[model samples]
Target: MVEIDPADNTAPPAGGKRFAPLWEPPPAPTRGRPARVNRTQIVDAAVAIADERGLDAVSMRSVARALGVGTMTLYSHVPSRDHLIDAMIDRAYADFALPDPDLPWRTALETYARGYFSLLRSHSWLLTVNTWRMPLAPHVFDADEAAFRILVDTGLTANQVVETIGIVRQAVSGFARAAAAEIADERDQGTDYEAYWSAQTDFWENTFDPARYPTMTRLWTMGAFDDAATPFDLRIGALLDTIELLIERAGGSGTAVPSFDECVRMSGPDPAGCADVDTADA
Candidate 1:
C-alpha cells in the first residue's frame, strides 16, 4: 500500500495542476464566540448517513441532525449539498490503498484493482453518486500518480498507458458493482446471488429453452459457472493479457510517448498540440 501523504487526504485524483479546497472555512464565525463544528465533522457525519441509507438520504438537514446542529449551520462549513458530496466522494477515494510503484506493473495494477473493488463494496453508495462532480484534490492525484508510476517503465506508449489504466478501472468498477448488488439483494430481499440463481433451478431443469441460448445451456451442462473464481478473477486476467499485448506492440522499445513525427502527424499544425499534453519526458 502506498503511504498516502497525510497533507492531502480525501482529495480527488488528477483534477488538474490548480487545486482548490472544496470550501473555505466560514471566517471562523466572527461573532458570538467561536464556532464548534469543523468541515471534517460535517463530512464524516454525511458519509456515515450515506453508507447506511444511500446517497439520497444524505441531505443537509439530515447531516445537521446527525451532528445535532441546524440545517443552516451546515451551510457554513459545507456551502451546499454538492460540495458536501464532493468531499464525501474524495474521502471514499482516500481509502484506496494505492499499489506500490516498485512492484511489477501487473502486480501493482492487480493489487490496486482489488483494493478499489473492496473499498467500493464497503461504501456501495458511492456507486450511485455522480463521480463526474468529484473535485481535483491531492488524495486523488496521489493514488493516480502511484498507479501511473507503476506502468511508467512498461513498453506501453503514453496513449497505451492511459487506455490501459482506464480499462483496469472499468473492469474493477463493473465487477464491484455486480458483486455489491448480490450483497444488496441478500440484505434487502433475503436472496443473495447464489440463492436467487438456485431459486430458478426448477425452470432451468423443466421449462428453460436450450435452443435460444445454446452456448449458455452447454456451459451450464458442463458446470462451467460452478468452478469460476468468486469475483471472476478470469476477467482481470484477460485484461492483463490485453495490456501485455499492447506492450508487445511497442516492439520492446522503452519509448513511453509516441515519436515526435507521430505527434506531428496527429497534431497537424495545431498550436495547442504537444505543449498542452503531459506526455512525460517528451
Candidate 2:
C-alpha cells in the first residue's frame, strides 16, 4: 500500500480524468439502508482481518463480509482494493500517538519509534506492506511530519532528514518483518516466540561446534540462552547510540539514524533463541 507523497503530488494520478458523480439525497431512508458507512468501520474491519488472519486474508470482499454489507456496497466507500489498502495503512498510523512538539528530538523520536513499533506489532500486515510509497492520508502525513520536524530540529538538512527517516523506517520495517515471520510460523504451531526459541536452544546446544564458534560457545555458557536477559531494549538502545554517533558525525544539529545491521545486530535477540528459526531464504 505505497502512497504518493503529497509534497510531490504533481498532477492527477495515472488515471484518465473522470467526472465526480452527482450526489443525491435518498428519499427518507429507513434504518435498513444506512445513509453512510463511517470510514472508521471500514478501517476497523480491515484491521480486524489483518490481526486475526494476517494481511493477505484482508480483501474488500472479506471486509464487506465483516461489515455484513454487500461486496458491491463496499465500493461506494472504498473505491478499489488499492484505495482500501491505502486507508488501511494510514489507519494503522492513527493508532500511533505522535511525539510532543515541545520534547527534545531524541525523546520525541524515541517515543515515536515506540508507538510506531507498537502499531506494527498490533497490525502484522504492516510488516508486509511497502513503506517507500508516499503517504497521502492526513494521519500518516502527520506522523512523517512529526519525524521530519524532529530530524530538522536535530539540525539536519531537509535531504538529511529524509534520508534519516528512510533509514529509521527501514529499521522498524526489518524488526516488524522479523516479528511477522516469527508470529506466522508460531500461529501455525500454536506456540509463541519464547517457546520456539527454547526448542531452538536445545537443538543448537546439541549440534553447534564449540571449536568452530568460540563466541557462541561463551554466550551459551553465560546462560544467554536461558531466561536471564531480554535483549529488546538493549538492542534498541544500541541502535539509538549508533544513530546518535551518526548525528554527531553529520553535524551537531541533525538527528542520527541507524542502519539495519546496527539495529538488528545490536538489538538482536539472543542467537540461541533463533537457532531453530530458519535463516535460509524462503
Candidate 3:
C-alpha cells in the first residue's frame, strides 16, 4: 500500500522506491477542432491488445496501431509504455465498483474480496506485472479505503487494519496467480484437467512403488484433486473465517460506527463524524 505523490513525475531511483507515480488523466485537447481520441480510448485499446495477446504485445506502437494513430501521437497521451501499463492496472481496479459498505463487516469484506479475485482472473496477464513498480492509483485507493472503513469500525487499531489488508491482498494475489497459471497451462496443452491428471496418475502408478507412496496413491485413488472448484471454495471460506476471528479478538465490533453510505451523506462542507471516524484510534 505504498502511496505515491500524484505530482511527482520523476521516476523513482532504481531499486530504491517501491512504487511509481499515481496515474493522472491526460490533459484536455487544446481548444480547436475536437481531438479524435483521449487517454481513456488509448488505454482501452492497449488493454484490449494485452487481453487478446499478452503484456509483451502492449507497446506504444502496437497501441497506436490498434487505435489508428501515429506512435508519437499515442506518446503525447501516454508518455511511455510503463505509463500505459499503470493506466491499464488502474482501469482494471476501476472496473470493480466498491461494494455497499452498509452490509455487515464480514459480508462487505467477502463482497470486496470476491470482486478483486474475479478481476484478476479475468485479466490473467495482470498477475505477470511487477506489483512493486505499480503505484496506488485512485481507484485502487478507493477500494482500500472502503475496506479500511469497514475494518476500523470492527474495533481494530489503524495498524491492525493495515496488517489485515496486507494479508488479504497477499492471499488474493497468490490464489489468482495459481488459478491463472492453471488456466494458461490448460490452454497451451489443449487438455482438460481430467485428461492431464489421468496421464500423471498413469505415470506415477507405473513408476513409483505403491508401498513407498501409499498415502499419495490412496489420495489419488480417492480422487482428492478431482473437483476444480472445491479448493477455491474451501480456501476462500477459511480466509474470511480467520478475519472474523481476528475481529472478535480485537475487542469485538463497535456499535457507534456509522455505515459508509451514512458517513458520505453526513459529510457536508464540514465533515462532522466522518472525519473523526476516518482518523480515530481503535
Name the candidate that leads on TM-score.
1
The candidate that wins on lDDT is: 1
User: What is the Å distance of residue 73 in model 2 from its true position?
Assistant: 1.7
Q: 2 or 3: which has the higher lDDT?
A: 3
Model 3, C-alpha of 259: deviation from truth (Å):
12
Q: Residue 45, candidate 2: how far off, in angstroms?
A: 1.7
The segments of candidate 2 whose C-alpha lies over 4 angstroms from its true place after superposition are 1-36, 200-206, 218-234, 252-282
Report lDDT (Cα) of residue 243, candidate 3: 83
Candidate 1 lDDT over 37-144, as tens digits, reads 888899889899888888878777778789898777776666566667777877877898888767888888888888878778878897786555546666666777
Q: Count the backbone clashes (under 3 Å) in each candidate.
A: 2, 6, 0
What TM-score does candidate 2 reach? 0.69
C-alpha RMSD for every candidate: 8.3, 14.3, 6.9
| TM-score against truth, every candidate | 0.77, 0.69, 0.73
Q: For residues 1-282, could you state the per-residue lDDT of candidate 3 as single tens digits?
A: 222223224353454222244444646877887767788898899788877787777777777778887767765566666667777888887877566979898888778777778878777678788866565677777877887776877776557777887788778878887777777778999986567767796676577887987897788788874643521341567788888887777774444455556566667545455655553322
lDDT of 1 at 29: 60
**Minimal lDDT window, size 10, model 2:** 17-26
